[model samples]
Target: MSVDIHFNASALGSIQEVSLVLFKSWSEKKTLPMKLTKQGWKVSLSLPAGEYKYAFIVNGGIRLNDPEANAYAPDDDEKIWSVLLINAKGQRLHSNQSYRVHLHDYSLATRFDGPGLPGVHKQINLAIDESIVSRFEFTQVEGLHTVTLAWYTPDARLLQWSDHYLVENETSAPIELMFRCQPKTLMQSPLLGIWSLKMFIDGAFVLEDDFKVVDEEVYSRRDFLGCGAD
Candidate 1:
């Protein structure tokens, strides 16, 4: 059966392309090219019913696991790979199903295009439902819960961070939170890389997701002029 696989790494800028390294038949390794899309990367392939593991290679290097991968297991060397099961259509298998948290809606915006640069404007909008308030340990007080936004480099290093946001429990209704997070200094400009927004409730990690600052799209004027070598 042919199954469609998708991987979005919009947060990782400067990436020209991504390829899928599929581990099939218990030991066979197959590499397939994935197409780039405005949203991210995707590929479709038909394979015999069985289990498989795969990893994404950025450009020609940098192996990474699919952030939205259904399942994952570590190898003897401690390398992690995404897992897949081709049993039925529309059926999914996840290892972290119980701990999965959902946001009502979320969106990210940035001013710089193509790849991230220093001091680029960035923002995030998050909506939460009253039903999930207990997940953040609503203490009936607005000042108890805290929200943290951290930016990391491509190699996964802390680059920039914002102060904690205190949650306000004024009503038991749904609420939306907006954060304007862009660095103001050259040191902060080093924030040009893939990072994750982490939500904390009383020092506990409640929500987290990764994002990229650059992609394969050519945005420079020189590239438009056919004068720049990409």
Candidate 2:
């Protein structure tokens, strides 16, 4: 269904453009330009029945998580943002786990979406949840090695991977790469199936995760047919 999302930035009278960057799960990222209204800077979108996280991009430079948003999540860098739940039924999606580090007194953990939409860009993402916020610090450190993110199909067919290599030590540094690909390139792959993501450190394997690529099933299902029980 469609919802009217409002943001109050009238205090910044000189501000001109305000864009809404909505991310359903971590995969689907849409940038909608908001119009200044008497109520506030607002925009309407027809989102499926599910949870979403959104932030207001002011002047295409500053990214402000909704201060008014009650539900929230943190990025890889521990920056908390506003999150919204559409048709939630107390169903938790991902499993959380913790790991101990040997040298840096650091522990690593990761969370990901259970399933995603058709577009590849919106299909898979790497994120850290709230449980490990206090323990993991993503501060940059030297002696980091090369990092790469790769995507693969369920049957182990490689679809597309990140060409840009990040030179940082995975063990000493923090994992902050959000793997995204071109919409057209991802669309060429199977629309409905399982996909996987593999992280490589200096050409050696690190960790792997998987997510489902469901079509309209995400919307057709009962969980998404309506908002939470009322």
> lDDT: which candidate is best?
1
* TM-scores for every candidate against the unseen true structure: 0.42, 0.37
Candidate 2 lDDT tens digits, 105-184 = 22222333432212223343222112111011233544223344555666665556542233336564454444453323
Candidate lDDT values, in order: 0.52, 0.50
For model 1, how does the per-residue alpha-carbon lDDT over 1-230 read when each residue is reduced to its tens digit?
A: 77778776544446777899998644688999999776668898877777788877766754556545665565566455667877655444555552222344444554223332223223221221111111122233332223444455556654544323334445764444545444334243334455566553322345566665542233677667896656
Clashing pairs in 1: 11-211, 11-212, 11-213, 12-212, 13-214, 142-167, 142-168, 142-169
| Stretches of model 1 off by over 4 angstroms after superposition | 88-230
Candidate 2: Cα lDDT at 146: 34
Clashing pairs in 2: 27-122, 144-168, 144-169, 145-168, 145-169
- Per-residue lDDT, model 1, residue 212, is 51
Q: Given candidate 1, what's the lDDT at residue 46?
A: 78
lDDT of 2 at 109: 28
